[model samples]
Target: TPTAVASTIKAKNYIKTITYDNSQEDFVEKWLDQVFSEALQIRSDNKFTDEVPQRYEVPIIGFDCLKSATTLIFMNLKSNKYEIIDRPGPRSCPIHIIVKSTENSIHLKFIDAKNYVSADMELDDFLRDIGKVEPCESLIKESWLLLSAIDNRIKDYTDYHIDLLQNASLAKLSCLKKYAYCYKNFNISSCYNPEDKANPFDLSMRYWKSKVNSYNEQDKRKKRRIDHNITYDDYQHFHDVFLTQRCHMCQARFTYNNKPTLDRIVNEKSHTKINVLPCCPYCNNLPMTISNQEVYDSLRNDMRNIKISDCAIRKPYLRIASQLNQKRRDVNAQHHYKWLTLQQIIQNMDYIHVTDDDTDSLCLAIAH
Candidate 1:
C-alpha cells in the first residue's frame, strides 16, 4: 500500500512507514525500499494531496483499494491510532504511504498473507520491473497446467474453476489458480505478450519437473532393489496361500487382519521360492526394526500376536472361499458340510492343484 509514496515529489518528516499488499503481482515491497522512501520524503516536504476525498472512512478506502490494487491504506503513527490514511491510487507509482509517523526517513515494505519476500530492498529496480512484465493468458494457463501436473493436484477438469473452488489444496496451488481464474474471467488480449526465451513461470515449471523426475528415478531404483527376484507368479501364489487360510508365520486368522502379504524368511537372502512365505504385513515388518541380533523367524514371531494392523494392498485381493454359492447358506451344516472352511476345500479340491513336489509343504499349511 506504500504505492502512494513513490509519486511524492518532496521529502516528508511525519510519515514513518508504509506497507504493500500485492493482490495483482509481487514486486511492490522491493520497489518501496529502493524507490519509495525518498519519494515519501519529497512528497511530505512539499505537501500531501489525494486525488479522492482524503477524509474518507478508513475501512471503505481499504476495501476499494484492495479490489483495484491501486491505493495504500496505512496508519499515521504520529497521529492517534484511530486515524488511518488512505493514500492516492497507484497510477505509475509502486509504493503508497500506508502509515505515517512523527519520526521521519520513511520506509515501506510488502507483507502478504504468508510472509515477507525480502529483508532489505537492494534489488528494488529489478523487483519493480516485475510488476510491468505483463504475462499472456495462454502462457499463464499453460504454466498452470504444467505446475498442476507436477504437484499432482487432482481436480475436476470440467468447469474446474467453479467446481474446485472449495478444494483446500487450492491454497498450495494459488499462483496457478490465480492465472487460471483470471484467464477464465478477464479479457487478456491487451496483456503484454511474453518473449519466447524470457518466460519466468515456464522456467519455474521446468525446475519443478526436473525435481519430480529425479525423485521418481530414485524411488524406482529403491523398489527395484527391494523386489528384484519376486516375480508375478510368486505374488499370485502367495495370495493363493493367504486367501485359503491363516498366516503361515504366526497362524493369525485372516479376516482382513493385517491382510496377508509375502515376506522373506531372511532379509539378507534373495526372494527365492523357498525363502518367501505368506505372512501378515505387520509380522513381516517387525524384522525391519526388531533387534539386529534376532533371526528373521524370531523377530517376525515376536510381534506376530498383534492382530490389529493396516495394509495397503494396491493390487486386487481376490478372496478364495472355495465354492462361494454351491450350497445354500445352511446354518445347520456349519460344522462339516457347508461353510467357507475346510469342508468347502473338499468340494473345491480340483481348484487346489497341489503338485507332487509341493504336497508335503502344503499339508500342514492347508490343515491350519
Candidate 2:
C-alpha cells in the first residue's frame, strides 16, 4: 500500500521540461507562444486521463542557448510541494529563470529553486546598473517572486556540514567516525614534536595557524576587526578529526606525497570551520583565484565524453586539471596575475595527456 501510494504521488507530481529554440528573431514572443502551446497540450493530455493522480503539472522550460541567448525557466514549487489540483484547468505555477552573461552573449545554467530569488535580485541589479530596467520591467515582474514563500531548512553551519558529511563515501564515513571517537580523548598537542617530521597532523595545525594569523593581519591592514575566532578545538572537531581520505574539490584519494590540508572554499572568508574543507596537497597547490564554477566548467569540458553521475574526477581528469592549473600559473607569471579563462583551458586539452600506468603505484602510496 505504501509503494502504491508512492507511485500514485509520483505520477501526480511528474512534470517535464518544455524547451524552445531562442535563436530566431523575436525569440521572446516565440517563447511566449510556445508556453501557451504547452499549456494547451497539458489541457488536452488531462482530458484523456480520468485519474487525478495521472494529471500533468506545470512543466519547466529550457531554452536552447547554443545558437541564441539562453534563458531557462524552472518551476518554483512552494515549500517543495507540487500543487496537484483535483479540478485543474491546465496547472500553472511560478517560474524561475537563470541568465548567464558572457562578453557578447548570455547563456543559462541549471539552478534550483533556492537560488532562483537571488538570481532575480542579481539580474535586477545588473539591469538597473546598465539603465535597462524599464525595458525588462514586465519580464522581471512575471518571473521574479519573494523568496519568503520558499522554506529554508538550512538553519546553521552545523546543519550544512552534517548534510555534506551525509554525501561522504563509505571509506570516508568510517574514517570520520573512528577519528571523531579517537579525537574525543586524544591530546593533539601531546603528539606534536619539534624534531618529528613524520607528524603531519601537528605540522598541518602549525601551518593552519600561521595562515589564519596572516589572514587576520590582512584584515588589520584593511581596518577590519579580526573576526577569525576559530579555536584549536574547533579545528580538531571539524577538520583534523575528519580523517579526510579524498580531496573535496577533485575527489582524489590521498597518497603519501598528497596528504590532506585544509583549503579555504572562499578566500575572502575567515578560516572558520564552515569555510574550510580537506583538500589534497596537489589540489591545494592549484590556482587559488579559480572560482568553484570555473573549476566545474573546466572539469566538465575536459570530461565531456566520459560518463559520470556527479562530475566526480577520474585519474585522467585529475591530470588534466593539474596541467590546466600549471597553465594558469604560467599565464599568471607571464601576463601579470591574469587568470586563465575556461575557453583557454578547454583549448589546451589537446596538449594535455594522462596515463593509467601509475595505478598500481598510486594504490600502494595510500596515506595512513
Candidate 3:
C-alpha cells in the first residue's frame, strides 16, 4: 500500500520585502547582506542559479513610511520564500529583517512593523500549512512510548549509579557475543577460556580510570555505593578476549564464515568511554543493547520457527489408501518427512544451547 502523502503548499507569494525603521536600518542591512550572500553562495555551489536568479538587492530605509512600505511588501510574499533575515525580534524595538524572493530580485523587510497584521497573517498561514501535513499516528505513538521508557530508565540510573554499571556489564557481554563470528578461524575455545589464553592488545587504562572517576562522582552526589575500581580498560579487556576466542552464544566450536563483525562496545577515549555497544547489521540497522537482546532473541526464534514450518510444507500432499500404495511413493514420502523433522529438531536444539563462559575470558584476552 502507498503511504499517505504529506500535506504541503509552496509559500511563494506570502512575503516580499522587509523594511527597517531608521533605528534598525544599519543592523537590518548587515543581516540582509549576510543571509543573501550565504544563500547565493550555496545556490552557486549547487548550480541552482538558474532556478533562483542572481539579481538580489538589499534595500535600506530610515523613515517610518519606508518601514511601512517594506512591511507591506513582506506581507504579500510567501512564508517559504521569505528567508529570516535577523534574530527573533524584541518587544520594544526589535531588530531583524527577512528576505523575500521576487520576480528578478529579492526584497528585504523588517520582521515587525506598525500593524500586528503581517505577523498574524504569517502565523495563520503557518498553522494552516501544518494542518495540511499528514500525521503518522502509529509512528508518533511508538516514538512517544519509546522516549518515555528511555527517560524513565535514565532517571532510574541517575538515582542509582550501580544500576548503570549493571546494565553496562550486561550490554558489554551481549556485544561480545554478536562479534564472536570474527574469531571463527582462531581457537575460540582459548579465547572463551581465559586460562587457555593468547596475548592480545592492551586495554586503555587511562580511559577506564576516567570513566570510573566520573561514575564515582555521580555516585557521591546520589549518596550511593560507588564501584570506583571498574575502569574502561577492564571493559576493553573483556571485549578483546571475546573477539580473540571462538565463543559463540551456543558455546559450539564452529568455524566462523569470515564475515565482518564489530565488538559491541567501541572503547575510544575521544568520542566514547568505557564500553559502547556497537550496532547489529542484521537488526534494523540499529545498535543492539543488552536490554534489547531478549526481545531480539524472542523475535528471531519466532521467525525461524515460522520459516521452518513454511519450508516443510512447500509441497502439497494427500494421504492415500496406504495398504497397497507403491513402494517408491511410500519411501519418498517417508524420506521427505524424516528430513523435515530432523531439520526442525536440530534448529530447536541449537536454540536451547547457551555458553557458560564468564566475562573474565574477555578481560583476559584483551589484557594479553
Number of clashing residue pairs in every model? Answer: 16, 0, 25
Which residue pairs come into collision in candidate 2? Answer: none
lDDT of 3 at 135: 27
Q: Rank the candidates by lDDT, best first.
A: 2, 3, 1
Instruction: Quote the lDDT for 45 in model 3.
Output: 44
User: Over 4 Å off in model 3, which ranges?
Assistant: 1-200, 203-205, 214-225, 228-368
| Deviation in Å, model 3, residue 231 alpha carbon | 6.1
Worst 10 residues of 2 by lDDT: 1-10
TM-score of 3: 0.16
1-368 in candidate 2: lDDT tens per residue?
A: 00000000011335333323334544444444444444455445434332222222233221111112122122221222112222212123222333322221222222233222233344334334322333244422323221111112112213212221121122333333333343344332231111312323433566556656765676567565456545554545544443444466555544444456667766666555677677766555554443455454445443321234332331212221221233333333213112222112222221122212222211101011
Candidate closer to the true structure by TM-score (higher is better), 2 or 3: 2
Q: Model 1's lDDT to the true fold?
A: 0.31
TM-score of each: 0.19, 0.27, 0.16
Task: Rate residue 271 of model 2 by lDDT.
Answer: 55
Q: Write the per-residue lDDT of candidate 3 for residues 163-214, one digit (tens) a residue.
A: 2212223343333434343323334223332232334324355544665576
Task: Report how far off residue 354 is in candidate 3 (Å).
Answer: 16
- For residues 142-199, could you state the per-residue lDDT of candidate 1 as single tens digits? 2333223322223332243322212222332343344345334332122221222321
Cα shift from native, residue 63, model 1 (Å): 78
